[model samples]
Target: MKLSFYLHKNGAKYAMLTSIGGCISILGYLIYILNPLQLILDKLLTFQPGSLIFKLWTQPPYEVLAKIYIFNVTNSEQFLAGKEKLNLTQTGPYVYQEIVHNSEAIFNENGTLTYKPIRELKFRPELSVEDPDKARIIGPNIPLLGISSYMKNEYGLFMNLGFSSVVNMVKSPSLTNLSVTEYLFGYEDPLVELASTYVPSWIDFTKFGILDRLMSIDNGNTITMHLSTNTTSKDDILYQYSVDIFNGSPGLKQWGYREDIPEENSPCNTVEGAFESGVFPRHLKENTTVRLYRKAFCRSTSMIYENTDYTSSGMKYYNYRIDQNFLSTSEENPENKCFCKNSKKCLPKGFGSLDPCYYGIPIAMSQPHYLNADPEIRKQVIGMNPDQEKHDTVMKLSPELGIPIYARLRMQINLNVSPDQIVTSSKPFQGMILPLFWVELGIYDMPSYLGILINIAAQIPTIEMVTSYILGMIGALMIATVGVCVIRGFNQNRSDVESENQGLESSPFLSIPVQPIIRSEFKLLR
Candidate 1:
């Protein structure tokens, strides 16, 4: 109303000025109230595919544990060997000796007249010695692609087509500075893609006891170290595996129990083959450490399933990133609900959540310290599985230390439907996305494309009322000033009329009217 009045009174100029003032004040007040310090925290929150915010939230006190094992793990490749040579011996006049046959000599240095390849050398990968990425040093007997024989025979280049590197173990007691990953098998850029990047050296020999003894290696135990950074979050589901390794191959042998995590399955921590013990040699008893830190950060309010087909969901989906703390509690009773609960690991009551991906004993990412191949002893140890069929599980499984955590577990959330999606806590998602994408972008990470909807729901229009009111107040004050001037003018005019009337009625300056007064008085008296 005041604004309208001002326009009529020619006070419209104040509107924009007052509005700008109001906006400034509003902006300041809103920022002051947010208190951003309260909202930021550190948790293991992964980037869920379908959400921009509110992702899988884990419980508090998830303890991260490390089991240090001292063992020697050797692969199929030989570091250094005696040379094969041709020699002549004297007996009678001309001692009978083996003829010059190149193919006959395989390993020994003393032969008849033929010198074979000296010794059939095991495969090794070519690698970059200079450390580029600041990561934990790698160890020996780890799995990786070896230099191919064809490439070595052709261009005289090392057989490794970027599939090897030297694991630098200066401080670590594992292997020496040997080449492990040089380049990807067929990759153009080694830095960007993960498939091009080779696995660490410790993945080669993953068994314990006779497994290493039978292969002629000293020790060949395998254990995975889960990091506190991201082991217990709502986003990632951790698992372990055993594999088979080629005796003469460069990297660690394949899984000694299972190749990889199984397809559409759960964790198998209770199972025996999931882990091994004493894989290292008796001569070297120092433990090797591998560390896996958090890499990608993302979040959402919803929990993403490893198996569910989220491509068709019509709901507004979510993804998020949140900094979380460790949440590990002791669950000693195997019969209770929290029986499987413990620090550094967990296995809930509902097991089906890990569909499309196998869940098993947790595995560890390689530490930078344990990298490098040693020039010391013996043979390589491989996985023991004789089955011809391949497994569908992809998660790695191991069972040495920490908790061999295989059991039924519950989902982060609980849902019921034709195909139900459940959520237990929102703690998994905080800080996963931006306000604009959650409220303005209108697109969800999920296929449903409902991010914009959530953004709109959280939005509010900027009101101009404060500015308008301020402008109206100023205009009204100006009009009041004009009214005061008009009222003063009327009072002045009335005062002047009153003064003129007093003069007219004052009898013409009675003193100067002496003669007229005498005449007037006489006429009155007569």
Candidate 2:
């Protein structure tokens, strides 16, 4: 009885242990299936005000540099005299630090946030090749060239005659020598003042600075972005926080898209649902295409996956290059037909007209040194050397986090000069696409704190998965051990029962018959 009691007690103990083991196994599986860590990460990555990602996005704590190289005219006099082709020499990499942040933030109930972008540029002399104030470049007179080009397109013969007379009276040269700072920032020119005075409606500003106007912070433009609060799908997460609207509109009015035009019909003018280079979609694949919008570019540019790369710290990144056909004419790419604007024929396969956005100036944009441009466009100039390594626009993005680690955005600004027989001052620059300057805006290195966060974020999934797998294995072993113990206990109990049965059958007392034992006892009593 004691042995039976002991076995029963042990069986109850084993049953309790088996239940615990089963529970542990179930708990491990639940952990693996639920992936609570990833859910926490998603919450942290949301664009709420107090979230870590929102703080980083609001005020980026990294250095962004703008390296500018001006094409200085070497032989202005000889070129104007028709004695030689326009000779140009690449001058410098005038480095400037760009400070950017979002201001006047307004959170909306529709899962969107609106804010005005504030950008400021400060010159970094230590990083530049030379002082922009001292370096002089003989380049085309931007004001004169732009005004002349506009007049030729919009005005009649009588207006052109009057413009020519005024040009001759001011003795405006086709080219002027000015310091790099004046060319980039602002330069006092009599023609600019004259144009402002005469055509105040068209030429509202008396100053014309390429960089100053391009990087103007007080434009009163606000951007609205979608916040990812709805779904946890990988693609949806990647598409999170993309641009939704600009200046209260999703399509650019300057690009001639009607307000009612569907997004599918007008892809170029539609600025909605693009990344502003501050962030990208997560889990980028080889076939993933990214669209980036910049106020300076005046439109969204597409980037395609090129290859894989690694950061200095060995973090993996996907390399994306600007689409080769971004600036192609309609003949080459039918989708670009909208970029023609008011022109009957599109600008060559290389150039995209920026006149619509640049206050009616005939400014065109191309790859630096006319890379991937028509061969004839390069043949018209003397010193243009297109090198892909130095001029291509590329962005290196972290696949897991969808963040841009390193980026190089290169673009060349040129004057689309059309020779005017009516305006004699423009005769020297007839039919010339004059290269002005090129800029490479980039972020070379990430801040240490940001890097640490990225590292942690990148490893979280792997760590969580590994820990879950280990727990599952441990739980499986525990359940298996409990099963083995229960089987052994059952076998031992059966053996004990069989031994007891056998002993009862073999005992001398039990072997005697019950009736005979009773009869013997009665005779003894008598």
- Name the top TM-score candidate: 2
RMSD vs true structure, all candidates = 26.6, 4.6
Summarize candidate 1's per-residue lDDT along 1-526 as a digit string, tens digits.
4333434554344445445555555544543454222222111111122222212111111111111111222321232121221111111111111111112212222210111211111221122223322212222211111111112222332423232232121111112222112210111222212322343332222222111111222112222321212334332222221111112221221111233533312221212112121111111111212112110000001111122111132222122111111111124322222223221223222111111111111212111111111111001112111111121111111111121111111111111011110111111211111000000001112222223332222221122334444555555555555566456655766777788788887865654857888999999999
lDDT measured at residue 266 in model 2 versus the true structure, 0 to 100: 73
Candidate 1 has its poorest 10 consecutive residues by lDDT at 433-442
How would you encode candidate 2's per-residue C-alpha lDDT over 1-526 as one tens digit per residue? 6456656777777677667767776776776788777778778777778887777777887789999999998988898889999999998899999887887888998888889878888999999999899988889898888888878877799988898898999898888888899999988888889978987986777877888878872355789888752475556654567888888888777777777657544778777778873876566677688888887777788989888877666677888999999998888888787888676447898898888888777888999999999889898879999999999999888887778888899999998886555687788887789899999999976888778767766777777778777877777777687678767767777888899999999999867779987999999999
Q: Flag regions of model 1 displaced more than 4 Å.
A: 1-137, 140-325, 330-361, 364-470, 507-526
Of candidate 2, the 10-residue stretch with the lowest lDDT total is 229-238
In model 2, where do residues sit more than 4 Å from their true spots?
A: 1-24, 217-219, 228-239, 261-265, 308-316, 482-526
